[model samples]
Target chain A: MLDTLDLKLLEEVADLHGLPQGAYNIRKNGQAADRKTTANIDIITKKDKPGIDIVVKPGTKEESVHIPVILSQSIGDLVYNTFEIGAYADVLIVAGCGIHNPSSEKAQHDGIHEFFVRKGARMKYIEKHYGEGEGTGQRILNPKTIIEVEEDGIVEIEMIQIKGVDHTVRDTEVRLQKNARLIVSERLLTNLEQTAISNITVELLGDESTAQIISRSVAQDNSHQDFHLNMYGYSKCRGHIQCDSIIMDQAHVTSSPMISALNTDAQLIHEAAIGKIASEQLIKLMSMGLTEDEAEAAILKGFLK
Target chain B: MLDTLDLKLLEEVADLHGLPQGAYNIRKNGQAADRKTTANIDIITKKDKPGIDIVVKPGTKEESVHIPVILSQSIGDLVYNTFEIGAYADVLIVAGCGIHNPSSEKAQHDGIHEFFVRKGARMKYIEKHYGEGEGTGQRILNPKTIIEVEEDGIVEIEMIQIKGVDHTVRDTEVRLQKNARLIVSERLLTNLEQTAISNITVELLGDESTAQIISRSVAQDNSHQDFHLNMYGYSKCRGHIQCDSIIMDQAHVTSSPMISALNTDAQLIHEAAIGKIASEQLIKLMSMGLTEDEAEAAILKGFLK
Candidate 1:
């Protein structure tokens, strides 16, 4: 029972053209709009809390879950979701949130997600934050993610925030065990008077564990952005952190990538860069019969691609 | 006249196979070993210092000068050199230093270079630093460069320090006027127990002034490095600063790139990144019939290229 606006928001945030095939949950305007569960996956709503717990069977394969949220009215919604992947199982989780407020009241959403991957398990998580409306109301979204990987487990997370959110602060923390691996990539953009702050921390605490964090962002007009990342190696592990940004017009960007190695065999490194578009690149594009503005737009599109 | 070792040192540092044409001066073992000059360029010994002053006439073109320093013995040497480029002229300047210490005594050299580019003039400066020898003594080099560009002037500088310097520090400063441009590119590598520190600063104080600073460095084994760069835009100007570093083994690297904009129309950005070699890149190279060590070497070479 979703209208055209709800369908469009789902497509924009989670790449959902219609109702998902596998287990899924859809919440709109602070209430559950649709839900479905499969035999291998169970999405049980918490009796004591305002959220759901997803449990996947052992050795489950080719199974996925979609927990997408949308808002068409101004409201304050806060939810907590937990995920547990069984041993040797592999799964995909798509949890995206979008807000379309057309009222004068402010619209805000806070989602806190916690995940646990069992021994030898693997998971791919994708979460997107988006906002759109022509109202005077302010759209705000705050997302928190915590993950723990057991021995020989692997986890990959992709977090993206493209446009329209007035304010956001993304917080993430991860811990890896023996022979575990973790990779997190975040891409974001901020324009107008919007501001975004991201804090990510990862710890490799077991032998041969590895983690990598990569972030790319752009700030345009009068926007502002800050990225703070930290990686710690406490055993015979390896870790790397990288952050890059582009600043345009009167925008401002600040990046800090910190690494600490406590063990003798631990190897860690970090790098960050923030600058505007290269003039030579713009000129090269303009030479191909494109206007200055068009060339600039094309370059920015490519940079964020 | 110079000996075989002196010629080899020249070739290693300044790319001079023999006596350089046009204008040139060679210093070896704390004394002048060769000298030459052309009609438009004059190399005159300083009366108050142990150095030389190079002067280029107005509208001069296709003219170049070489001032290469070589130290084959363990000795302490210090020199100060200055250059004056006339208005509407364009020229190239090569100043490189190499030290080969084979004695038990420590070898050190400190060079301070100052340049004044007149109105409408342009200059290209190339400098390379290198050290070698199987000696118990340490090799140390400290170079300082200060430049001031007048209206419509341009200055380009390339500084390189490859290997074998046990300890070194480089310092550079620049100031640009209206329509003036300054570009500085630096490349360095440190290994073993060696340590290197670099400090570079630039100020854009006029309308339409521009400055760009690019740095690439690699630290291997137990080596350490520190790179500090600063750029300030005081008027309606543009400036950019970028630093990239690769860390290997038990080595450590720290980079700080800071920028400040004081005017409403001023635009400035700074970026710094530090990391190890990508495993995928190494695997790709190894698939082409290369060993792991060879692939690592090839990647490092390409990175610094």
Candidate 2:
């Protein structure tokens, strides 16, 4: 039972525009609905399988496919989903998970997604996790994402979590083949006693492979955040990791980025900074007639953006 | 007796071009020589005084004075020095300590310098510490610098230690008053089995005060380095701390920068980065017919410069 607010929240987090009348859509971990024949995408369900699979065939002319799995305010069971993207398919996938727990008897969701990118294929994946509830129940989400990029394949991922989750543990692991490339950009904001931990590991196994990982986070009001990224270079490759965070009001943040190389030609680097808001930034903004609180809010918005 | 090599090393560190015939000069922990009337600087030595004092009177017109205290190959004692700059004085002091130990016994130099800058004065100080020896004797240097910037005063300090020291611990502390400004730039390079630790603290006690601290370091082979900087803001002030390091071949480096504020208008920020050389940089240099080692050396030179 989904209402207009539920749909709007799902659309905001999952990039859903209109109703699922033409393209393929899945609702509440259910079967595919309103499937299009000429869309080059197929959704199938096993007779006794617990999760559904959406496959994008090779050489698909479609630019992207949007599939959002949402949970409503009622207490419900956890959902599991998987995606299989074919080789040589140049497309984008807009996928995310949104939970609205107003009645709140402790709602939870655990999504495990694995991606396979074939040779010479390029994929852009964007995922945003969000939660909202007025009830006293806890909202928890634990996500595990595994990605593999074949030779000459390129994959770019952007993950964002702005608010509302009480606790989350995100784990991502990636492997790159010869000449493959991977880029991951993550942005998170935790406020009011929330907790977030991210563990990411990348391995450059192929010659001339490259990887870049960037994380930006903000913690306020007794929140806690920990981020760890490790990159291993086995062959002649390049890698760079950057972590930036802002801590305010008894909040605690820790960032540890490590780079290890077994090859002589491997080049790797990492940069991390954790501090409070700069006074000059606030002064410059407040000089334009805004209050101190307004200035801080504006700076935080710009930093997250 | 100072030979050609000794003179060259002193000149390299203190920028001494010619003998001081009119200005004060000190060598080997000795008293000031070549005292002149045109210079308003006085060197005072008292009985049982552990360190010598050089006082610069007000309205001193001399642009710069070079004072280098050298230590030969013998197992010697410590050297201490102090500086007192009067009000309304605008001058530069280029001072350094170089130890050439070619013996079997351990050699060390502990130089402690304190500076008192009166109100409305401007001073620029540059200091370099270096050591070289072929024997198994340890070459160690521990230098402590204390500075005070009065109201409307400005002080800029640059410290450099490139090579040859087996171990070093550099400690610096500064206090700034109303409208006062202080800037400190430190560059260090540790190779082989050497180690270095730098601890710096600054307190902004007056409104409109500012301070900036920057550190650049490189560690290679089995060397280790640690840097810590803390800034406390008691009024409306601005401060920034930056640390950049390059680690290679079993070298370990750690950087911690903390900023605390007691007032509402204090703004502070810090940034730190540690990593090895980038592959693209090496590739770009090698494409121009340079070898890997040559590219790395060039990059290191440019970074240190």
Candidate 3:
């Protein structure tokens, strides 16, 4: 059952203003609380574990699927979800997890998700990690996303973790086949001694394949973050990886991005930036009547947006 | 004779409102236009070349010196300049060059400047490069800056090149001794098929030495830019280098930064980012009643600022 706090969290993470339409699965307190299956999509619970297998037919189109998890008590939860998208199918998959810990104990969530996008299919995946509590309990989330794109498949991913996660380690690996394309955009924020680590590796293994990975993050009040991204371009492909972080109030950030190209026609580039807020930005906002703090917050909001 | 165009170029490069008061030298069209020396600062013209040796007294303070070069006609100019700051002296030096070529011939300026900041002294150096004309001839500038800081010395450098120049090559090298500190900030802009290349190297050779190099650049309209920076911490020291660039309208930017730390206590970091303007920034400005073009210009201006 979803309470007021649970509803607010669902809204915060997945924009589930009400119950999601089409096919959906809601997991709460380490168990599935609700589920639905549409005509074109099938959700099968894993017999051996605490997860599900989502399957879409070859001609499925314009369908929205939501699989969100929420925890309101101090506990440790793990799940393995697999997605099989058939050829020529187009769908949006929304999977976000939120945890609340009000006790002295810790609340953690670990999820491993694997997606297989079939030939000529287009998939858009959005995942958000969120934490909320009243007491001093630490909230943690670790997510691993593994994806394989078949020939001519297209995928766009958005991963966001912007508040109240005391610690997290996000791992992602992706492989692209011939003529496939991928775009992954990620954002994160940490403050008050929180720590976040991200490791991502993408390989363009077929000709004419391309991938772009972009990340933006901010650390404040002694928080620390590390970003490691590796991109490989082979067989007349192209890839790019970029990382940008803003460090404030003694916070530290480390960014290391590597790019390798095997074929002579393959092109790859990597870029990273770590710095504090620009004083001119503050001045410009102040001239428009906002205080320094307000200006900095506005700038950071725009940065993450 | 300093014509109106020459005076405008002077103001654009060095902020020269009138004849400089304390110590000044103005070079116009491959010849010296004016020269002046104050009580504590001596400008010695080199007998064998078209350059000068600047010597500052041991205790000179709160004074400014200006050296400006203006090329109104198509010509090639080369000069070698040196600075000798006595022990415990603190001063500011401004050196800027502007070229105007309204003919069918190439115009170029090559300058090599070397500085020695003695023990316990401090120096502030600023240089700007600009070009303007209405001709097909090329406007090119090549500058080299070399500096050495003795024990307990401090040096701050500001180098800016914005607009007009068709081609440029900038080279800089610095060495720091025990307890010395160095900070160098550079900014550049290229447009309309222009090209710019910058190479810089720094060595922290003694205990407690620290150095920081920051560069911001923009390339637009088929322009090209390449930035290469290297920092070496050979002892118990710290060093940081950052390069940020905005690429627009088919432009290309390449940033390569390397940081090496040899000692166990040495701390070094390097960051670089090359991207287009953020859409959020544009929307933010557009929300404030500006058009898209106006918003983009504002963002670029703030970025360079």
Candidate 4:
């Protein structure tokens, strides 16, 4: 829900900008980063197509310079719908990846990043995962991202992933320079699927900078949710994180939120929590005449309370 | 921090079994349930009073039936240690008057509540406004709790409150069945004055039920922390909770955890995390290169390319 819709609001912001490649230009001029180029090799990116079907490889020679990057991916149906995040690209909205219908997802999962990369743009990316079919089995989508931010640049990424029958493997990378800032928020709701692994990396190669990460999740039934957030802080840098999870029934949730401050004055704090519901507490409420939904609502509300 | 070795373990499991009220028992031939008496508006029976300076009141009254009760007061510089789940009579922890500290905190911020409530006992109570201390003032601690469960049954309650400059408030209630369960977890890290309105109500209306709650806290930079938790459940039930908090740069934190369930099949989960570090993200690790903490370790070992 939005409070108000101001169409020209982006133009008012000094750093406001947007991806220039319209859908048509994106389809025609945007091609995958040149493939064939290899870097420190890791299996996750080994297929070399850079995980893209079209065999374009990363250009030879590392960009060496730190450039702000934001990763974006969406999983579910609803592919053709348009998404808008102010012109500055601070908010990333992702939709469209068939995760619920196993048969449809087998075809392929497509990601759109070439448009921004080709423009040499630096901005935040918002990723959203939603479902269209009734029940958890009809929709599923999985996507990964990579982002690099330059000095004094800022990248804010917000991802909301709701699991369907299909799972998602999200891997995002960001390299920041001196004084660069990055803020990432990942929210996940998992019901179906064996697991959801979110792998994120941020290199603080920069000095006196800041990075913030926050995650909230709900794991129910037999679902498994794992999150790995690691931030390496330089001297005089400030990094902070908060990770919270709610587990139900046989559901299991694991969170590893860590901060490594190599330099003095690198104030950093990391925290994680996992646990199940209280039954006797619920019965006491019921005995008080509250209905089942009321009880669940009350108990569940306390997670936020 | 625990007062004794046994208190250490008790802090870890108080949520599963009711905190023990050692030697605080009613004379076997003293009074019957209907014959119990009270002195304060708040009710406490002969069974709940120990050899203490102050008592809240006496007698236990059910909405429909009456039960036995007890009361006791904690003196100055007294770090009332932890209590075993199976070593004492069913009890309630309450803070009725006010508490004060000299060095770390000032007055104008005092709260009250019973530290431990017995299992298989119906309990109810409330606390007033709570806050921070002033120059040369004192710090206050007021927390109240109740427990009800069968032999070996358990209940635990944890709270944090910071309201005004002169005082604070905390209230709790719990009830258990022959073998019911309950647990409480509270964490608060803040500096500003805070008032807490807390409650915990449970009914052991069943056999073999349980409840538990845990509180974790870290405060720095002159901030105040406040928290409150409410728990209630029934027979053969089980409950667990964990709350973690960290404060920095004169920041403040206030929290309240509530648990309520109905049927014997009820199972609940609650977790609260308050911190300044996003430990599960790779940004911190990439920033420092060291990967020893849980979040960093997961990224270095489990989060591949």
Of the true interface contacts, what fraction does each candidate have?
Answer: 0.07, 0.07, 0.03, 0.01
Per-model lDDT: 0.87, 0.77, 0.86, 0.42
Taking the tens digit of each residue's C-alpha lDDT, what string does model 2 give over A108-220? 76767778888888888888888887877777778788888899989999989988888899998999999999999999999898999888889888999999998888888
All predictions: root-mean-square deviation over Cα? 8.0, 7.7, 12.6, 17.8
lDDT of 2 at B244: 81
Which candidate, 2 or 3, has the higher TM-score? 2
Write model 4 residue lDDT over B236-290, tens digit each, in one string.
3555555555544444444444444333243544455554444446566666775
Q: Quote the lDDT for A185 in model 3.
A: 97
Q: Which stretches of candidate 2 lie over 4 Å from their true place?
A: A1-9, A17-123, A136-153, A165-178, A188-207, A212-305, B1-9, B16-95, B103-121, B137-151, B166-178, B189-207, B211-305
Candidate 2 interface RMSD to the true structure: 5.8
Q: Could you tell me the lDDT of residue A8 within candidate 1?
A: 91
Q: i-RMS, every candidate?
A: 5.0, 5.8, 8.9, 9.1
Better model by DockQ, 1 or 4? 1
- Candidate 4 has a DockQ of 0.03
Q: Which residue pairs in model 1 clash with each other?
A: A271-B273, A271-B274
User: Can you rank all candidates by TM-score, best first?
Assistant: 2, 1, 3, 4
Task: Return the candidate ranking by DockQ, descending.
Answer: 1, 2, 3, 4
lDDT of 1 by residue, A189-282 (tens): 9999999989998988899999988888888888878777877777778887777777777776666555655454567766565666778998
Q: What's the number of clashes in each of the models?
A: 2, 1, 0, 187
Q: Which tens-of-lDDT digit does each residue in B157-195 have in candidate 1?
A: 999999989899999999999999999999999999999
Tens-digit per-residue lDDT, A1-305, candidate 3: 78898898898789998799889999998999899999999999999998999998987999988999998888999999999999999999999998888887999999999999999999999999898899798999999999999999999999999888999999999999999999999999999989999989898898999999899988888787878787766566778877777777766666656554444445666666665677889999999999889999999999999
